[model samples]
Target chain A: MPDEQARRIVLASRPHGEPTAENFRLETVPVPQPGAGQLLLRTRYLSLDPYMRGRMSAAKSYAKPVEVGDVMTGEVVAEVVASDRPDYKAGDLVTAPLGWQTHGLSDGKGLRRVDASSAPITTALGVLGMPGFTAYAGLREIGRPKEGETVVVAAASGPVGSMVGQLARKAGARAVGIAGGPEKCAFVRDELGFDAAVDHRAHDFAEQLGAACPKGIDVYFENVGGAVWQAVLPLLNDFARVPVCGLVSQYNLAGPPEGPDNLPTTMAAVLRKRLTLRGYIIFDFAGLFPDFLRDVTPAVRDGSIKYREDVVDGLENAPEAFMGMLKGRNFGKLLVKVAG
Target chain B: MPDEQARRIVLASRPHGEPTAENFRLETVPVPQPGAGQLLLRTRYLSLDPYMRGRMSAAKSYAKPVEVGDVMTGEVVAEVVASDRPDYKAGDLVTAPLGWQTHGLSDGKGLRRVDASSAPITTALGVLGMPGFTAYAGLREIGRPKEGETVVVAAASGPVGSMVGQLARKAGARAVGIAGGPEKCAFVRDELGFDAAVDHRAHDFAEQLGAACPKGIDVYFENVGGAVWQAVLPLLNDFARVPVCGLVSQYNLAGPPEGPDNLPTTMAAVLRKRLTLRGYIIFDFAGLFPDFLRDVTPAVRDGSIKYREDVVDGLENAPEAFMGMLKGRNFGKLLVKVAG
Candidate 1:
């Protein structure tokens, strides 16, 4: 009675620099049936993040790269259609790593149940999800900003940066956000309640950043890493802590950046200032997830922690949305509404 | 009467690159008098270290630069010649920041009493002083190498590096030492008891480092930067800790290093490997000095912890000794014997 074909996107080729639509290919395949002890899932929404750019390249990173012709890996909110396992049943919602596909089969491992009545189900892929947890764990572990200290983050309107600013403000620290344009900057300052927002695209971005934080930055939640990092480096105070979560701007780089080499200067500053720079992924702090949900969910429900989503309709638009998101074209948490 | 025309080295000029003899001027001035609450100290041994190179430059660092025509700043093992302070009297030995002068007046501030019978008084300058404390605090607070983990340090035969390796070994970690030549390398491996010693002068230095660190480096006590860092960067394991105490190699660097800019690569690795890099100076952990003395004094007295000194005679030879130390020509702790 229902259509047997299911749609999916696969990695067609690796890009040399910025990724393009051609690097991904859409295909139709038979919707997989649930085997013994497995559950059938129909995708509701697929989340696109900067980390996906790393998976496309054939280079060694924290995680393995997505091979050519394999379905591009991603997190998705899905509805359980049928279940062979006793724990899950029909019409139940869950968040699973089912990737860029309309339907998939899950073995019940790594699937987190989503309670629809608590909040919007889409929030699972944004505010209460990996991005929020990344900000939380990184700040708690590395960037322990004291009250009145300044905390800075780029991509201020994006999920991780938005949460980072909110958390920093909650900790009684001054929060500064850096975004590309006026509208996002306005949202970061007015809507997100960051102490100040700087436009990175401005001619005097570094000077503006300096003006925003007169005390100098104490905690910098580093997501976007190219020019923003260059601006932030000199502004970092002695004993500053940098929780390096992602280098979204650098994910697409093909080779080393243009000179004058900044490594020596960066290392020298790290030494002279007694700064601490630590790299981390959300999974590294998975043990803290229960604590993360305990703290963040109530704030989300009470409207104290706000989140925004730029959701594109249909699975076919995922490639364009992802490419545009890489260029920071999306205003908030970028997601693809794969199905109703 | 003893010579009233006391001699000291003054900063004649700042060096653009490597410091030359012309940059220092030996001057004769009337011996300073100790007023009430002051102690006059006669210079016994003047410590020469790589940090002096930084003081010779106009560039801002952790400590203030020595201004032109001022006595060049250094620590000295001094004998209390005359005392107006109740706590100190004539012939009492003390460690003082009395610069390069033959005689200096102290207001009793920052003068730590040296128990002449406890250990060699010069140990107050090398093994039991700032250099020794640097290795202890850095390794304890930042490095924290676990049992069986590997620790790497450069300037292997120097005070800091030698102590770092021994401390790492004490902590049950494999200690790898990097030095310039065969003699220093031999001293590091055979005498200092580092698990492995790699010659930075070897044609295949990086390969040798890699071979020595079969499990990869877990903790790196960064005393020397530049090529050693380039070698250590890739070999760093996931969650590797880098305690940056000094950058001896780049102390005289005038400009950014030659490109293909290494910043992006370094930052990328930092994120992907989840590395932790922290910089610190000894004073930052001065509170741990008592604990350091408690742990180290016994080891030194028992001959379990050993040290070497490359002592040069005369205050006039300090300039040459200091210059040679910067170029790694000095085999051990570089000091000038100002008087018996």
Candidate 2:
């Protein structure tokens, strides 16, 4: 019963625009003892993603909005401290959707025991987890980057985009990455080995993207669908494929921007260029998860694929870190280290 | 030989706006004799398709712009008047890229010998040919209409739209058809088996379209993308697929339309609803031809597919008919009858 204390963050209210710390509250409750076929978890890390902002809004989305006062939904890398489940035992590290909790009890279903012997436990959340799978599935399944083709991904230093750019390059396609600032751009270019990295906040971002992509963008891994889409769309080649995985840019908007609306022009361009814009959730292609892990996990081990993690310590800092993430303050994949 | 005389229509001048008959010239010329391995073709039917207007203008397109003073290009059903090639004999009915001419000589290439037995040979230029292929491939490939889903096609009485509307119905979806006038709308509703047909020219066309489909449209087969698109965009369901095949309504404009530009609004909807908008030329999906023939030709045989032809007699009148067709003056597939 020493594993009875569960420290967790819960949604207090849906934020109208940018999330504030007041929207989330940290509390402690007695963690239930594992019953038959269950495992007791000591949460070590909570994977914070941009997509969490979507769950904090009342807007309809591919995933269900997190209910009020429930633990803020997320995947966690945890150590199994105790177990009534025969499948797992103490000292076994595993990945589970344990939300923002410091300790959790699992039914032993949907838990995958990680082999820390193969790689460090943190890699499970960064390169080998949801973020990595997102990049793999979106790039291969929707992006379908052809050899010698140019693939452009926004938020290049972020986990999904970092992998998307790298994986596209691995497939023999030229990868152009777009990040927020010069430093992140340099990191993506130098660290992740992206072919070109442009800063979206630069004075000549559109021109820089144009100059970098002389052959025109063949695949645009669209994670940010506001000005980035506006910039990337005109530069798209006649047969470009845009895999719409997330619209992180629009996650904070209360409503549509005021406009001399350009919807018709977008439709016109889509018609003329024969562009393919497809929206997808990661699990929509869950049938490919086995293939995703098999292909991406080893690429991480050999350093052929690289990743960066921006760890914001403690559950209380989740809200502020997420808010800063919206403003492009964090570099790389943003994660909250809840407990050890 | 009588085959020595050739009657043809050529582009006289590029139209600054809607093409007038003055932009075309009808003339008689010496028909060169068929050389070795060549056949003299006497055009029986010249297909007056909307795409010809794009060729006449200096506008950039997927295909090369037709040179001014060149013979207007089109698909024609022709009769072999003389042949030196063993594959084709005189008096044989065939489909050829014969331009807008009464006579042509082919070296037995790019010509498909039509049996004139399966369906009317004219159909080779209409429902069973390029326009039909445009509809089938667009609807099946991009539209991906599910059973019980609502599908919409504009210019619904035209060769392409009529086929799209009918095929959507055959796929077990509800088809909503939009046409310019009451007559065309009636034909689309009655003969084409659409669930509802709305007249685009109606004062309350958008309201009518909304009334027709209580559930929002799931797939919009975009052939005419002017005022109709304005109405269609608002009615699109979340995750709707818009296969933009043509912009017939905007073809005549010399420059982009002015005032109340709606591009931003469209992009916002695209992001908000996770909509997909793709443009494609028929040749992009030409690989589907054999399969298209297998599926659609059978529908034609059983009357599950129906087509209407607006046949204009005599090659000299082709220019006038074509001009009328652009104004939605001609109904269904516009064809010029050159010879019996």
Query: CA lDDT of each candidate?
Result: 0.93, 0.86
| lDDT value, candidate 1, whole model | 0.93
Which docking class does model 1 fall in? Answer: high
Give the TM-score (vs. native) of candidate 2. Answer: 0.86
Q: In candidate 2, what are the lDDT values of residues A209-306, reduced to their tens digit? A: 99999999999998887788888978999989988877888778776565544555565677768888877777777889889878888888899999
Model 1 pairs whose backbones collide: none
Residue ranges of candidate 1 with Cα displaced over 4 Å: none
Question: Which runs in model 2 stand beyond 4 Å of their true positions?
Answer: A1-42, A67-71, A79-92, A101-110, A258-261, B1-40, B81-90, B140-150, B198-220, B226-242, B249-278, B294-302, B314-327
Q: Residue B219 of candidate 2: its Cα lDDT? A: 97
Native-vs-model 2 lDDT?
0.86
Per-residue error for A153 in candidate 2, Å, reads 1.6
lDDT digits (tens) for residues A33-124 of candidate 1 = 77899999999999999999999999998889999999999999999998998999999999999999999999999999999988899989
Weakest lDDT window of 10 consecutive positions for candidate 1 chain A:
A1-10
